[model samples]
Target chain A: MKLFTKYNRINLSVMAVVFVLSGIAYYLLISNLFIHELDESLNDYKDKLHVFIKQHNELPRFEFFEDIVVTYEPVNVALKKKFVLVSRFNAEEQKESTYRQLTFTEKIGDTYYAFNIAKPVEGTKTLTKTIAATTLVLLLAIVSGSVVLNRIILKKLWKPFYTTLEELGHFKLSRGYVPVFATAGIEEFSFLNRTLSGVMREANNDYRILKEFTENAAHELQTPLAIIRSKLDLVIQEEGLTDSQGLALKSAYTSINRLAKLNQSLLLLTKIENRQFAAVQAIDLEAALKEKLVQFEDFWNAKGITVTADLTATALKANTELVDILLNNMLANAALHTQQGGSVMIRLCPGMLRISNTAVSGSLDNTRLFHRFYKKAAHSQSNGLGLSIIKQICDVQGIGITYRFESGFHHFDLQWPV
Target chain B: MKLLIIEDEKDLSDSIRQYLALEQYTCEVAYEFESALDKICLNEYACIILDITLPNGSGLEILKELKRQGKEDGVLIVSARNSPDDKIVGLNLGADDYLSKPFHLPELGARVAAIIRRKSFSGQNQIVIDHLTLDIRDKTLKNNEEAVPLTRKEYELLLYFVSNKNRVVTKEAIVTHLWGDDVDMADNYDFIYSHIKNLRRKLAEAGCPEYIKAVYGMGYKFSIPS
Candidate 1:
């Protein structure tokens, strides 16, 4: 069975805690029995030795009694003092024995080189080693069991959350806003997913409504504009238009032209807002850019600006018309902002294209690049939405755009993946 | 022929009526659908110039009513909606033709005149002088119990010829009538010459007396001895 990844990072930490708890419990139970048995057996051995010693009328020596001591030492700490209990009889009729735990006490006078008992603690090392080994085994089992539990039980317990996540992964806003996630019984998760789905639905609903409004407004405005233009045509064709009258007619004509242009720009903005460029196909960017540049050459020449172009054979998967609009807006902005003799230089590399121009330095604000309906206070001749259009195009086409004032040039480098 | 134009804009409808009247077509106007509908129910008109989108209700509804009443009255639907789907729908609902907004008044008059002729008589539905017959609905020329084939465009040129029969039709008028917008694209009038030649040959080979006559540097005419 495969294990869950999320629980693994924490399992070691949680299991370390659980493992320590289980190890301490097991250690307490096993080591207490071990030490109790040692103490009891030692006492019993002492009692037996007492009986034998009294019958023979001899006592144990302090140095030799070390062999019978209870051996208990935690592996974590060293044995500070190693000792055994020894007893002595003052008189034959005395009932109380003088006993002391002695590690270094030596006998003052020993007659006949006699000691009645051999109380040796030499085997305590092996006993302590065995207890330590048992505690170690208990600790290993606790850790392994904790790891197994995290894999088997915790992973299975989080299965519903994973299933919910998989369902959420399949949800997308474009196809439809409806989410198919069934309510999991987990309240926190249910609340979280439901709230997320609700927020998504609201956002999608707002987007759809705005999109519908934009389209409807654009469509509905066309008829009135046609009416106005047709009416204006009649006035222009009327009889007796003299010189000053002709100038007034020209003014009216310019006004109509600007109005029509404004209407077209609004419609274009609405289209871009509605994601009309989403269903783009692979377009030859080189040919498309050349066509745009060629179409604008006459206009730019009339404006007394020179266009230095270097187009290459390159392609990009994007909406052709949007890219066309982007190039037009950028070039038009350059033409408007540059001096009469200024040059707009365009270059293309393997996967990047750069358009650099000499502009009125420090005039364009870098911050108002993408703000809609923002106009510069000083440069009121042209709309300030040129850079915003470029930014939108970049966002939609997945292209990278950077605007910088580098080396006295207004440089815009548009990069796309190959 | 009298035509009633229903449009909300007074100045546009006035200008259209004035232009068509100058073209010698008797025309009237209704600024709203209700008045248009009342006039339509009360009077006989050769054609109705209807706007698809109206203030009170769609002009399509009036066209629908006229259609339901089995009125063979011709209709030309005009609208600002320039999409192809709108044209198809309007035509599907029995509009004889459609014009997008901002159209030339002369163009509108031409279309109205053509639709009226087509509604009144099925394609050149006239015969002249005993030996020649024009069966426009069948797109055939008969010289007593025999028929002949005409190329797709030869038939169109012949119809143009017969419609303006017995009088000279100008080359400019023929281009405007036959080619309409396509005349601007052609380098010369050689294609018109070819179509006229094909029509003449087919009609003559059918043992039909030659009725198509051409004037030098002018246009063609379909004639028979009065």
Candidate 2:
């Protein structure tokens, strides 16, 4: 999963396999050398027997040697000189031990005899075992030491990378502040940081440009829209206008007003996103909600919608303007969507606010509800930015908003952090 | 009373001037900052409708100039920037009111009239139209010294009509004026019709002539019947 863990798994496994294979090869090489030495000594013993037989005309006494056994056997045919290994039982130790034995034929006055000389290899075998055990212990120690050292050093070496990751996690485009990465000594990490810095710089630049464009476009539209509206106001006052003309002017006026509102909504959204309303103070939620309710009282009455409120005094630290807009948009949304004679209910607790209104339609598409210009009905008169504006204000104010439909009522809930 | 409109847009300035001209107020126009400053220095006006963004400089500078001269003229700032920052800064600089652009001319007229009334009338803030007397301070209406009770919205609607008397005010303007533009009630003006009907009934009961007339399908015009 982690880079260090993945590298260590592959590195340690390969090292373990190589170490075991080399250890086995080392053991075999050492044992072969021991056998070769034993063979040489046995051959020398055979040569000595020949010399003794020629010099003394008799076989040397076998009891004079230690750890070597010599034997003679009458043979019908002469035996070729060769080396062989044999296992013999030892009376004292009560165990079978391997010996290197040399067999040869010797002639004394036309009599043929077979001679076998054998020597015990128990010490060499013990020596090989000791060397093998020591090698295994040393290999294990080296592997474990390298593993521990690699973990510590690698962790320290990748410290800059983790720091970069943490800083990236906290980066925000709305803050408009680019973070400077700490210089790293490693080339690969340095390159990564450099690339990231360039990307963030570009992103911040693009964001600034986009924000300015939105503000400027909205601002520029305002004057022209004002001129058009003023001209319309003058035109409506002209004498001898027919009712049809008045209707046309009214429709035009409505469209122009809608356009103006849309522009203003976009501007407000941009402002909220830019964090322009940064002044924060403790706002009494109960008082604010009550005030908003009073403002919407006329609309509710006009639509014949019954209103119910259960409010508790709660305080939140947020920008006053933002809170006002958030409350206004939410209440307006509820008032606009509810059918005539529908009931609107509001409940406010310490950290939660819920506003639900009876709706003829079923649940709205929650996924697309907060997206700008997303409307449930094609013929709905709403510009579809009201909920989005509410969502934006809630986001800026650190409030969580959710929408749901239950029991023929559309419910909007706002949660504030304690 | 004399007024000065310092705005860069000629069409908008002319429209405002034309609208207020019907109220018997003389309006002078300045299309740039330097000319506006020259005019402000040269004359005393009852009100100055200042646009914040001018060709040469900001209108706030003109406000500062007015404050430097210690003039007591009422100043109303208009800007296309609907940002609260400009509004706050403009008000802080002693502008009497701040109106964002794309405003209804009637709303502008009402604000300008309010500013002039506050500046000229001082504490004796009242407007008399025929037998109807609107007490601005107490927010009440009187017919020949007989107190006429009016609801809060009725009073406000009556005051708005009195401010822009004899001129057609659209239902949209009245809706925005009463409930603000953020209420999303643009498509429905039935409530406005009811309010107007009630106001007319109440005024007619108080021996006031039929003053409010529906101008075809356009809107309402408050004037003495000819």
Cα lDDT, all candidates = 0.63, 0.89
Deviation from native of the Cα of residue A267 in model 1, angstroms: 2.9
Candidate 1: fraction of native contacts reproduced: 0.12
True contacts kept of each: 0.12, 0.61
* Cα deviation of A305, candidate 2, in Å: 2.9
In terms of lDDT, the best-performing candidate is: 2
Question: Model 1, A217-269: lDDT tens per residue?
Answer: 75676666656554544444444456676566555644553444455555556
A220-297: candidate 2 lDDT, tens digit per residue: 999999999999998887878988998899999989988998998888889898788999999999999998887788
How well does candidate 2 match the true structure in TM-score terms?
Answer: 0.94
Considering only chain B, report the TM-score of model 2. 0.98
Instruction: Please report the interface RMSD of model 1 to 1 decimal.
Output: 12.8
